[model samples]
Target chain A: MPEKSKSSPQAIGYLYGRRTRIFSLLGLGIILILIIGIATSIGSVPIPLGTTAGILVDKLPFVEITPTWQDATATIVLDIRLPRIILAGLVGAALAVAGATYQGLFRNPLADPYLIGVAQGASLGAVIGFLLPAAWNLSGMGVIPVFAFIGAIAATVVVYFLSRVGKTLPVTTLILAGVALSALLGSIVSYLVISSGSKLHSIVFWMMGSFSGSAWSEVFLVLPYIAVGIAVIVIFARLLNVMQLDEEQAQQLGVNVEKFKIILLAAATLITAASVAFVGTIGFVGIIIPHAVRLIWGADHRFLLPLSILTGAIFMILTDLVSRTVLAPTEIPIGVITAICGAPFFLYLLRRRKRAIF
Target chain B: MIELEMRNVTLGYDHHPVMEDVTFKASPGEVVGLIGPNGSGKSTIIRALSHLIRRKSGVITVGGRDIEKIKRQELACLLGVVPQLPLLPSTFTAFEIVLMGRNPHLGLFEAESRRDFEITRQAMARTGTGKLANRHVNELSGGEIQCLLIARVLVQETQAILLDEPTANLDIGRQEDILDLIKNLCRENNLTVLAAIHDLNLAAQYCDRLILINDKHIHAQGTPAEVITNANISRVYGAENCVFTHPVNGLPTVLLSALKKKEIGRNTISQR
Candidate 1:
């Protein structure tokens, strides 16, 4: 074929240019590090920035510095604050990426990590684990998360199969099925919570969501699941971009829509189930973080996923800090803080754009 | 030369068969138009050929290889489809949407290379969509989106192209421009083109062979002059005295008119 003569139309450049994207990524990275440092220093005890850095460095292998800070300060920073911060970051990043993936897969801006009954299912399982005799709890690797993961995958599978009409998976039907199943599972969880005689307070606390007792063990437990899930999602980021089009169009473009959907749903659900298993259901991070990223940067998943990870970590760290210090001796539930901070900002963004953010 | 052939193919959703025992062949360097009424399964045929929907029985082959046996990427490399109405993400730029056509050519982990960008850009230029590259798909007009879809198909660079109502939303000038582009591409690249067109005149003008479908089967298949006769149009389309040859090309065209009172009265009497 003969080449068509090109008449330039005064190039408008990319909507999100490469240079701007890279710079935003680097800037967010630096900001995240700074926020972590600042956040570690500002908790209830109010450790000095220098002392915090010294404690962190001292813990690093082969770089042992003399303990300049009090032993109590070291214990508080290393044993409590660090683990809580890291777990909060992991859970936030996991939820945000999972939310983004769900949004892209369903082609609905309203889609969140819990859209397909994962939360209710995990809650039901966790409640069951809580009610069980303390004998079932494995050493450090609690039985609740394992049951939650199983419950989450099973509920999603059920919803997926129920909503499928022949080979087509209609988004509306899927959402309806998820809602129905979620209500059913939620009732079961409530019933379980009511019947629990002595575990009521702890169960309710877990349900309300907290990182109060988060330990390095819980952090280590969630790290692999979130890391692996995020890696898989990032690998398929471009395909996820193509999937923003209707399923038939994606299929015509050589995407095995059904297979891709299954893989993505599994990965997103796994990370979400893992995150919620320990931290309870932290709301708003899944929905608000992705929307905020899309509002500032475009909806391209290549950028959306990584940007969500960074911003989600930062947002969670900041929110956790507020939850710790806002009421001082009485820390608020992190869920309450996220919703309080996230919902208003999200509404502001939606009103400002007044256009389709997806 | 690649040929798209569907032999004894039956397609439908669930248990209800829409088109049964359909057989046809679109050869290289030829344009075949599927002309039918609104519900005559024209789009179903296109979908089945693209493997967007499965055929119940028989086989669809591209370049003498069964489409079912071909992997999705390989099938996409062989055939490109422009859906009648495609839902695109509103936020995506035309450039990004067009660049996605290169997906079939790339490996699973491979991002678009410089060469792929060049090809996509060249396609946009050819289809006159370069000016719209930076614009969001949601902001584009219907004709602009149609042109972008065509540009995307061009970027695919397949051996066979399937289009469902390729010019459904275009004005007269753009309709001709798009058809002319497809024709030129067919001739130059030796690509087989199969398009489902509602406009009888346009089908007759552009298609080397026209397949008229009625009542879930192929009613007639031949050159425009042979297949689009007055008797065939009246019998299949239930329109009497509408067929006429185009003055410019001497190809068959249909002239439509409002239903007369006498015809309505006669039809009422017949019903009674």
Candidate 2:
């Protein structure tokens, strides 16, 4: 490479751009809280802010709200809002962390959980459940998540081994392998759906992503996977940062790059699989939320991973609210709302990053 | 004390050996230059020493401990390497890039301490890159990024530093600056430096000992004056060059013999 002229503009002073990022994150957090409070309050039956607060306060272990307000808000808040908010938060965080880790692990900003075949596999599993008469009997409506989780894990393993041709797992080859595998899994899912003529509607609706079936029991089921995944990623943040360098350099620097890669892959697969199991396949949340956080917080996985978790939670809660209200009584799929919101933002980023390689 | 020693070492890709029975020692407070033509196994020597690639046979010792017996983190604490081309993504700052040197000292969930920050700062200061500390590493000029990579090794604070063609892509001024910086670091800190240098003149200028490699063997090994003679240059590199003392530094240097293209072309044409 020839030396550039000294008179050219230098890429310094980029650190000062943090102020806007800090303010934006704060603003986003506030908006998240407002959306959760307001959206949850305006459901099939409207609950006033006063009543919502009363129900919320009463649920706290130590809080004692006034009798009248608690009675008015109890069923709406406890039976509906609490589960929905918790589910939204968990799903959002799960998707976001998965996105950030994938981006860092692959050393490509555009990589997401869905890009590596997790979503496709989960969708396939959901379709499989839809086809089986046993699964449809509602005797095993509860088993959908289990099937989806297993499918996701299987997809991740296939992609990983397909990319591992002997000692080196070149980034380009891995990404190409992922795309191919995703297409294969996607076709299988479509075939299953098409074959189940009567059950096609259920499969299609689930693929679109929804929170309509979320309940307190489902929330508990998904919580442990998301929590464990988040903990594992946070603990391994520093190791993930080291992995951005070439594998030889990273190994020489004392990182067990192969082991770390496996750990990250397993954690990311667990979270995405679990989140998609019950919530259906939510598009854009995994790809969009992490990118928004990274653009705000820089790419040190230590901070980026945690911040993405929070930002993801916020983004999902708000998007779910929009899905619920956009078509009153109709309850639009959350996936539809996220795609409509995320696609334009993604395009804007793509345009800005025309020359910027991550 | 011997900081690094390779004895009867053999290296290869998988099962086939590329180089055999190589022996060398880098004692504390000396800089050893590994010089050779392209594909002469210079980079392989660095890789084998750093444990980036497995050795086919023989023993490597660091600080009197067998390299194979040392754990990865333990080996890292004693040695560090600066690759020919350091990779940096657009998102990493110079400070963060240097901080990665602390990996050997950190636990799985550890955060950077004040001591770690101080060491990173000192490294930046030593490499004359403190002003660029917060700047994105990938956006910097090649020379600037090379300096930052050296700074990262400095932060590692290892007793031995291995460099593979560190100045290969640098301009003349930057090359001189980097070589001088490396010499100063070795002298001041008692660092055992083994650098694979492409420029023979630069190696002759800074290295206390030169090991000439060709055709997967040590062609010659001696002081610069003994190893950099015209006979050696012609035999090893197939270049018709005159050996002379550098006018200012009084060091052995090579001056290529003149050969007009028409004269060489006509000779080859006649022979054919």
Candidate 3:
């Protein structure tokens, strides 16, 4: 067959073309890799950028490089900084994708991973874990994340049941119920904090979120949840787009709205719980990164969801890097860094484009 | 080709019955217009037929199969709908909205392929909405949005179509154009169509048959001449004589007169 004419619309993949979408996914993947390598080298000792790349490439299969770096530098790159960098990226990707899922599922631009009380519940669980007697704290058990995970799931289930009117899971009711549960859980956490004696400072620091002493175990623990959650979320991307037309139209378009919503909610909540369980609640990423991706790459969730994964991972790593280095040993919270950097940058992007992002 | 039938269906919210034991059927290649007063279950019936809501007491079948037994995805391939007050995301482009009609055909892992794009573009062209493809949904006028909704439904390529007040926001010209397009498509494709139209005259002109709803029941069902008579209009709408034959086509037409003091019957006047 003859090549299609370029003047007509069919010559490309409708709007935004396949080129832009592919370029976005691939380009951001490369940037994320670069950011990870650079971030691993930037902390405390400040290793050289080339040495960081060499160290990273050396770890790949069958690649052997002559050791030019000191033993301490390798320890910093391989053992300490690499794990933290990987953890930050995984958490970031999880939170961002989860946020995008909530926004699409609720059809509200302001929605985030924490919108459904996942943060409050996780915090409560972490606080309880923090206050528990030392006898219960076993080595390598990682009690806090487990407690946080259970708390998050429990809170979501309560909210889901509360929001149902007959058989339908109304979005408005879901949001309202989430808000109500969040307030209740937040108050309980605060009470637990006040009643506790020596654990208060550690509790507050953990709640603020950080990758200060992240371990490879933490990364491994979080990988399965985030990976599965994101895979499920991407599969529902097209359905999420149709849902923007409201549930009534979605049903008419052939979606089982009730079943679909539950699946999405479960996936979003899972990744969010995984992310919050380890690093605390990183606020700005889930809410803003998706919007940023949408403003530049249209609102098709197929591209929007995947692009957010890359954008979010890079953003989280960079924010974690700044949090540790900008304060230099004092260690500003990662949550603080994310809000400070994300809001202004998102606003700048919004101002540059006159079109509506949501 | 499909035949849509609602057999003794009761539709409404919980503990409420908007319409009771309603029975109707539209055959293949038929345009069935549902005319009703406000709150008389037009939209409710449309929802029931499309499987958006379950019928309380009866069966709704499409193409001789129970709709309740059909999977939602398969039902979508068989039926398309143009909602009255559709909520289109403002950030989405018209082309993207239209392309969503192909959702039923796409698999979980699949993206929009070349053929889906071609069909969507053709649907937009057919509905005269090709010019608005790149424009955001919020930027378009209501009539334009309605036409885009039509284009979206057209992309479904279903064997049956449902429309709830499909021309409510449109001007007279666009109203006639959309109805004519719907009628032509119904006949040409041998597809079953059911539309809830508020305009009695427009419904008469375009619909192959009419089902007039009054007081939560299908009060009249027949051809335009049989159902659109002066007596039927006065009894169902509780209005004075307003039905007349169209000069051009001799189909039924309605021209309303302002309520005048003399037009009120002496009994209602005395009671007032």
Best by lDDT: 3
Across B152-238, the per-residue lDDT of candidate 1 in tens digits comes to 999999989999999999999989989999999999999999999999999999999999998888899989998899889878877
Report the TM-score for the A-chain of model 2. 0.86
Per-model DockQ against the true two-chain complex = 0.52, 0.38, 0.47
Off by over 4 Å in 1: A1-12, A57-67, A164-169, B257-272
Model 2 stretches with alpha carbons more than 4 Å out: A1-31, A70-72, A135-141, A165-171, A346-357, B260-272
True contacts kept of each: 0.58, 0.47, 0.60
Counting clashing residue pairs in each candidate, in order, gives 0, 0, 0
Question: What is the TM-score of candidate 3?
Answer: 0.96
Candidate 1 per-residue C-alpha lDDT over A26-108 given as tens digits, one digit per residue, 9 for 90 to 100: 99999987777777788778899999989887877899798888899989888988999989889989999999999998888
Computed on C-alpha atoms, the DockQ of candidate 3 is 0.47
**Residue A100, model 3: Cα distance from true site in angstroms:** 0.8
Error of 1 at B272 (Å): 28
- Using TM-score, give the best candidate's number: 3
- Clashes in model 3: which pairs? none
lDDT of 3 by residue, A155-217 (tens): 999999999988889999999999999999999999999988889998888888998788888
Per-residue alpha-carbon lDDT of model 2 for A1-358, expressed as tens digits? 1222232221223334444555665776777667667767877788887777667667779888666754546876887777988899999999999988888888887798887788888888777776666735555355577778788878878888998857656667778887999999998887888888888887888888888857898899889999999899889888888888767777778887777787888898899999999988898888787776666567767767877877888778878878887787888888888988877876787577644436
TM-score of the A-chain for all models: 0.91, 0.86, 0.95
- Residue pairs with colliding backbones in model 1 are none
The TM-score obtained for chain B by all candidates, in the order given, is 0.95, 0.92, 0.95
